[model samples]
Target: MSRRASGPTEGAVELRGIVKRFPGVLANDDVDFSVARGEVHALLGENGAGKTTLMSILSGAYRPDAGTVSVGGAAMSFKSPKQAIEAGIGMVHQHFRLVQPLSVAENVLLGAPSSFRLAGNATEDRVAELAEAYGIRVNPSAKIWQLSVGEQQRVEILKALFREARVLILDEPTAVLTPQEATHLFSIMRKIASEGRAVIFISHKLDEVMAVADRVTVLRAGRRVATLAIGDSDKSELAKLMVGREVMFRVARGDHEPGAPHLTVDGLAATGDLGLPALRDVTLEVRAGEILGVAGVAGNGQRELTEVIAGLRPATSGTVAIGDRDLSASAPAERIAAGLGYVPEDRLGTGLIPSLGCIDNVMLKRTDEF
Candidate 1:
């Protein structure tokens, strides 16, 4: 397939006829994608639709089995991420790669060639200037561990900008951000594109794509489905193109009567990892045959509440009862034995071991049974 540029400007980054294969899966099957200078091009697809693989190939994390890459209309080959960075292409992945102990400036300039000069506050000054220019609000001297999730994300973007990246690829950038933070990020993306750089935004959010992108490309089952200008498309059409079928915007749910209270918590209090009060006198109850959702901003004690309920963290003060049984002081195993099934947010690391197979992971909590 011929590569279609997102706009009238020359291609800032182009991947033509790209093909990548894993052991038994074709990650990218002759895919073609292009992002023009000063354009915010969004990439949309379902899970395992090869969006990441295609971006990985472009970012030099993986070599294409068959394809061609071009930057600023100049054909080039990159064998490593360093090569890609030198070529003015940078990708900020979903999970950040910053050092927790290092400051924002230190993490941004950690592996830069010019960072070996042993300069004093020059690094922090430069970072502050860059952040100011891009409207990225972050304290350069703040440690990564001390920053919020949104601030850490800004540091990642600062890292790319400090490297002089002309083609910035962001993978699921708003997944961890609040609505307000996501809006701020959209402004930053627009600012970057206005500076004659290209932004390839990879996300599954149709509304955000409609709001921020000039054009969007849909990939289905590892092949390019279609690329349409934002003005020429709507959410419904984009949804159909993404999954190769019509998508329902809403689903009908049957009404059910509430039964006795199954889970109850009163005056819950807990401290965060940094010894700060996370949850303060929170109270809620969930009745049987009903679903309750706890909604809050990213760092607002949701995890702490869950941990306290599951006995993973000590609650400073609270009464947790599961069907009339007080289990706030119970151990994790005892809570599990009391019919509590806790699935942590970090699924792979906490809920299940990645290296272990399904059966082994399933038997983790039932080791004594074996």
Candidate 2:
């Protein structure tokens, strides 16, 4: 087991007794976290475990309702995201924020301080240089829409590094990448930390946390549970800390024969929101009383397949049938009426209305039946 130290200073960024609240929940309660320069620190938690809220406070997206945030040993009170950036803190959110129509270099240079004048092609050349340094290769002149999800992620990391962020926060950076791409990203993170910069990444994947982070701070129910060195901790220990329970990492799969197809999709074709071809001639079937897993690296038509089947997206060419009822041309309502219960991946927006109460959200699906 190997451990690296940040040298001199004990921590580069620190939070003490941080507290934040929403209308109905204590999002963060007297939580404390710290990361050191020249270290890759991982923040781990389950969903709604205050990981995002804590990072938001650190990045100046949300001022802490209470407590203190210090950067490079100096206390900080950030008024906006810009303030955080100026303080050498940069966060790449789980969702990409780049403009689709903008060139890679343009997006990297967006909102840069205009006080410093650059020679023509200097910005592009610098972007290229940073890309090469980080092992991220992308065409600087190409529009964001032309890049793959992995490539887009590279651009996000490059943008942060270009801004000279001393403390870089990446939220679920591998959620959209293949195993190979994730490995590459881990290498880049090591390079960044070795350069005397602080790298804080939010992740739920236990394997990644163990592999990339030198130290980890686990959050549970909006409070800090434990901060331990990677060499001393194992997956079972970390999982227990995150959930406050002994978690079973594996499930027993009982054998059962599959019945007739409950869901059938044939020759599905679709275009992404950018009007680019996403799915092509995909065919699959899920039998009744059996589980079917669609496994792939992210952004490889999995979302399109689900949307087309749920009638949320139009299929350019294909047929979808649920237990003999063809839903290829059906609207979402029609599909719902035909015994399709859709729970979208985005829980706040498409899955349920945030403003509406639970009763009302339930009624939204059965209003016609009522």
Candidate 3:
């Protein structure tokens, strides 16, 4: 049941012939993995390739039907996420799990025992100190709701670092980061590993993996296909490993000829559950052959404005017109029929169905348009 890499590294965690099933699909089958301590291992795979599934098992969010997991030569079975967390395994999801109403420090120290809570100036002081120490900067007393996307991420990493996590797992950490922020994070990662903690980084960015990983494990269709050292892998080679064979990283587009507005919005407003207006009379329009980019620092009126336009959420007062149709009274499905193909911004939790296949998702889009 055991599969071995060419050589062993210290602080090693091993998984042998793991198998997991969920109703119609076998998510993992005879999967094997080994990660050395103090090393940054990059997990590579396509969307449904079982990388997330395997990590979920390791993080104690799922259990393997028939397999063995051993850390430092000791066999262990985890029945829950808490059990795994207690065993020094910490996971930061692609989308963070922070409470927006809470402060940065509060979000970092949300779980764990009661004796850890701090108030007044001490909590803020410690959080600021810890964040700066890791090269991850943030204002501790600032509410999570106000922080930028990158800042929130720093807080997320701080959560694991503050816990003294020996094994830190980050999923798609740099997906939304600016290039500068990404570089900074990689530097911090190296320093963390230098302290003898294992880091498991899951990402689709080939260059980042090659840049930051000590070794790379390629998973395809729920199977471990290859494990290669960083020195032995290239972006093209790694991309092929994740997706099988080759891929063309290009998008097809036509000439940049602009046209009139297909949809228009002005003075739109919507209140949240707390009765505060989330969107405050925003105005915008999208034209044919032109791409309108909404630049914001996150949690602005972007989502609320889009929802109002898409007919998902009703606006308190405003004009939303789809080619002069005045779609303020229309439904979400109606907006699509009027030539608005909303791909949505949130992929997980709000958009993608975890259980569905690639083909099935494509089918959904086609059926919706038809």
Q: What TM-score fits each model?
A: 0.83, 0.93, 0.77
- Cα RMSDs of all predictions? 4.3, 2.2, 5.6
Residue-level lDDT of model 2, residues 1-370, one tens digit each, is 2337533245889999999999988999999998988889999999989999999999999988999999988999999998898889989899999999999999998876664335688988999988888878799999998998989989888888888999999999999999988988899999998888999989999999999999999999899999998888999999999999999989998888889998899999999987999999999999988877889987788888889999989999989998999889999888888888777777886788888998999999778778
Q: Please report, as a residue range, the 10-residue window in candidate 1 with the lowest summed lDDT.
A: 1-10
- Provide backbone clash counts, one per model: 0, 0, 0
How high a TM-score does candidate 2 get?
0.93
Candidate 1 deviates by what RMSD? 4.3
Question: Which ten residues in a row are the worst by lDDT in model 2?
Answer: 1-10
lDDT per model, in order? 0.90, 0.89, 0.81
Q: List the residue pairs that clash in candidate 2.
A: none
Which pairs clash inside model 3?
Answer: none
Off by over 4 Å in 1: 1-6, 22-25, 115-122, 253-257, 270-278, 311-316, 330-344, 348-370
Candidate 3 accuracy as TM-score: 0.77
Question: Sorted on TM-score, highest at the top, how do the candidates line up?
Answer: 2, 1, 3
Question: Model 3 over residues 1-370: C-alpha lDDT tens digits?
Answer: 1112344368557889999987877888899998888788988888878888888898899999889887667788999977777677788888889999999888878884445567777767777888777777788889998987888888888887766677888888887677888888888887777677888889878988888888889888888899998877788888888888887777678668778888788888897656778888688888876778887545556777777788888889988998878988988777877887766777766567768898777677458545
Model 1, range 1-370, lDDT digits (tens) per residue? Answer: 1122445476898899999998878988999999998889999999889999999888889999999999998898989988888888889999889999999989988876563333889889989999999999999999999999999999999999998899999999998899999999999999998888999999999999999999999998899999989889999999999988899999887998999998899999999999999999999999988889998766789999999999999999988988899998888888887788889998866899877799999898878788
